[model samples]
Target: MPTFTALTTLADGEKARALAESMEEMDPTPDGVGVFEMEDGSGLWEVGGYFTEAPDEVALSLLAAAYGARPFAVSELPDTDWVAKVRRELVPVQAGRFFVYGSHDADKVPEDCVPLLIEAAMAFGTGHHGTTLGCLRALDRLMNAGIEARNVADIGCGTAVLAMAAAHVWPRPVLASDIDPVAVEVAEANAAVNGLSEKVICVEAAGFDHPTLAAAAPFDLVFANILKGPLIDLAPSMAESTAKGGHVILSGLLVEQAEEVIAVYSAAGYSLAHREDIVDWSTLTMRRE
Candidate 1:
């Protein structure tokens, strides 16, 4: 059955409470319908879900009339039988000497990663995204040069998937950070799932400028898969934290934006070593001078 969800937000809690009283529950035809809200100190936001085969036109009109500013999204729940079909067709990726498994093939990851399912959620890094694959390929190329490190860090570590991949290949202590706490939890879980929790440290931090990160300075390698604006902003800090012969892998920029990001690092004593492009985003690898 198709499900409809309407999102609403009130500038204040009083409006939220008042609006809640107006919701209807008469001709309910599905498993259930409900309202969910979360308050983040900024304001209260709610999503009202209605599960009905027939459109609740009258009720919807009433809510729309009272609160026309509310937005809605409609989505259908997929059948369980199609899970395999969906997985196979939507996600398959390979980069460098690594094969990331988010594929529909139940066992998409090769024997080496046989233990890791590589379940592809909406998480940040799956190596399925072009940027992530670009990073992987860059890492593999670096590997060919007999690169190994005692310390590594991944910035904007969404889901920490790449960090996990790194831990699997190298025994180094990997530092992973994200500003989002939810992402920190997910990354930690992913590391543990892949038996890398002990080797990877997940923290809620932003930028390479933090005191703790600065104290741990001069990592052998750093992986940052964030967009150009921030990359440009943090170039000096990132370069400063890199060991003299270490490298920085950067992503989250369009092919056109690479030069701008590269210019920032290059000006700070880093030399460009490699570049990878997928779709519109490009990833660049640089070695500190």
Candidate 2:
């Protein structure tokens, strides 16, 4: 497959969603931006966000229409070389002591992470975003605190990044869940790569929806890295699945969005523990009181 990106200077507005849904046929936007890649030879198109100062409708639509005028040049990838390119493009990053690497980058990742290489094609939590980094750091804090959790859940598992981190952080059994099946597949592969297949369970479900999550009873720790709206909506699920005195780590919200998310948990008897800010994103560690 060849990917071409389209750049659009559509500032923060309702137009953003409209522009995104317009290109739904092409490919789903990645990283929650106006960015979309051509799944086939269609070529990559990234709507590079325009400056907020972009001119009125006439100019905006003109640029938007013009991008499609030129042939999107698609790059050819050799089947054998795909792994090498993904690793080079999305370099493995280390947050605190946790490491994020592509399945192909397993050999390149520092030995400390126990190296879990999720396949290159896997989307979502590829470990490139601040949300993933923030989550890793938050997970590390739990390990550093010496909190022992026999049961853990990583909701919205997104490539099972947090679940893989949890397996490395503790000897406990961790259950990973994501609404996307591809994420589940990659997560399962990652678990095996990290030598944690036996310790971590990957499921195709949403926010602890699987029977294993239910069978495990209330978990000692839970990790959720979904957006503010979904996070708030699923607050009850997380609260219910967490043991009375266990803990929950929340991420994937902006600094301004944290208060509302925190409010949801705080009302449910979770007392805040530590707050980590990476870029403008925030992740909070809270314990069930």
Strongest candidate by TM-score: 2
Least lDDT summed over 10 consecutive residues: which range in candidate 1?
32-41
Model 1: per-residue lDDT, tens digit, 1-289? Answer: 4554444554544555555555545354434444434423343556455554644556655654565425444455543444455455556566766766653454555665323335545344777677888888888888888998678899998877667767778877788988778888888888776678798888888887456577788898999998776787788778778999999999977787788888889898899999989987788999999
Question: Which parts of model 1 have CA positions greater than 4 angstroms off?
Answer: 1-90, 103-108, 112-117, 209-212
Estimated TM-score for each candidate: 0.69, 0.70
* Candidate 2, backbone clash total: 18
Q: How far does residue 246 in candidate 2 sit from its true spot (Å)?
A: 1.0
Task: Report how far residue 181 has shifted in candidate 1, in Å.
Answer: 1.2
Candidates' C-alpha lDDT: 0.71, 0.70
